[model samples]
Target: MPIDHKQPYDESNIFARILRGELPAKTVFESEHALAFHDISPAAAVHVLVIPKGAYVSWDDFSANASDAEIAGFVRAVGETARIVGAEPGGYRLLANTGKRAGQEVPHLHVHLFGGQPLGPMLAR
Candidate 1:
């Protein structure tokens, strides 16, 4: 079930645990403001998740509170992660599920980078 984005940031969230070094992640890239790692349940050939270093419930929270430098670092980390995972140059897709309606299973903010194969349509409908 998706969690509400407005809810308090859960320190025990999976991503938070991963960040705290309490849980293992297949790290792909890491920077001062972000960390990128391979998704355990990949939706595509190249499904990596890029998340900010700070505790944020979702994109809305991150954008509203994160500093410009933090935001830039996070964005740059995403791009660097894509390049390292071979999802740039050719093509790739970035997806961020912000709210319950968007199927945000995890409360922590994260961007999904998918590529390595032709992703048919943006939506199945």
Candidate 2:
């Protein structure tokens, strides 16, 4: 059987269209590895999504297949984007939801960087 490269039982990925520019986004920072944009449905004062340029099924799949450089570049981009969004000094939260169990509505692997105010808590289970 062919491996389903498509995300299993998840909604359409946002990063794909953001890469294609099909959807409008407020991009703060970008690199070869990832792109950072303000979340359309923001949960906090400074809510941004740091997404890898390549489409991955989820965080686990991304970690398994992504190269060292790709991973490093992504991490660096996150820090840069955080500063751009003014989430560094005030502190921020990086969130990655993997599956439905974890409230991952979008299948594409991404890190949500949010701050600029006091976050009540991480993800509520």
Task: Pick the lDDT winner.
Answer: 1
Worst 10 residues of 2 by lDDT: 1-10
In candidate 1, stretches whose alpha carbon ends up further than 4 angstroms from where it belongs are none
Query: What are the clashing pairs of model 2?
Result: none
For model 2, the stretches where C-alpha displacement exceeds 4 angstroms are 1-12
**Residues 1-125, model 1: lDDT tens digits:** 99999999999999999999999999999999999999999999999999999999999999999999999999999999999999898799999999989999999999999999999999888
lDDT of candidates 1 onward, in order: 0.96, 0.81
Per residue, candidate 2 scores C-alpha lDDT tens digits across 22-100 of 8888989989999999898899999999988876767788888889988899899999999888889989899987776
